[model samples]
Target: MIDTNQFLAQMQEVLEIEDRTLSPDEKFRELPEWSSLAYLSTIAMIDDEYNVIISAADFRELQTLGDIVRAISERQP
Candidate 1:
């Protein structure tokens, strides 16, 4: 099972907002650092870490951080 805390920590690192606290229901795009760069960085992080290849369209469709976690979890064993 994927650890939510570790996921959040990786997300914070990827988004370059390690100081902020992240919640599962938080809207990822609402973050101040969320941008094209952040989006691509997230995609890369998810792929490299989770071995899940999420497309740009799919990434754009994600709303909450929980949604992203579920997506990755679904892709893995």
Candidate 2:
């Protein structure tokens, strides 16, 4: 089972977010840290941590951090 909190922490690390804690409901794209680089980093992070590869197109469709967690959870074996 993928834990949401752990996932959030990983996101914070991957996104280089340190000023504030990440919430599942937060719209990640709206964050100042969010960028093209952040998107790529997130893809790599998910692949490395969860062994799940999320394409840029699919990743772009995700609105919130919770959506990302759910996507990864659903794809995991």
Candidate 3:
């Protein structure tokens, strides 16, 4: 099972965000550091950590960190 707190921390590392903590309701795209590279890094991080492959299009549809967690949970066996 994936813990939300741990996942948030990992996302912080993957996104190279050093100054602030991520929240479940936070709109990641609104972050100042958000960019194409960050998007790709997020996809890679999800794949490596959860074994779930989320496409760029699908990823774009996700609005918040909690949305991502729910997507992964629904896709898991």
Residue-level lDDT of model 2, residues 1-77, one tens digit each, is: 59999999999998887888999999998998998888888888888889999776877789999999988988896
Per-residue lDDT of candidate 1, residues 10-76 (tens digit): 9999887866699999899888889888888888998899899977677678899998998888788
RMSD of candidates 1 onward, in order? 1.3, 1.1, 1.3
Scored by lDDT, model 3 comes in at: 0.86
TM-score of each: 0.89, 0.91, 0.89
lDDT tens digits, residue span 1-77, model 3: 56899889988998888888899999988988788888878888888889998766777799999999988887775
Model 2 TM-score, all chains together: 0.91
Candidate 1: TM-score? 0.89
Candidate 1's C-alpha runs over 4 A off are: none
Model 3 alpha-carbon miss at residue 3, Å: 1.0
Whole-model lDDT, model 1: 0.86
- Least well predicted 10-residue stretch by lDDT in candidate 2: 53-62
The regions of model 3 sitting more than 4 angstroms off are: none
Give the lDDT ranking, best first. 2, 3, 1
Best by TM-score: 2
TM-score winner between candidates 2 and 3: 2
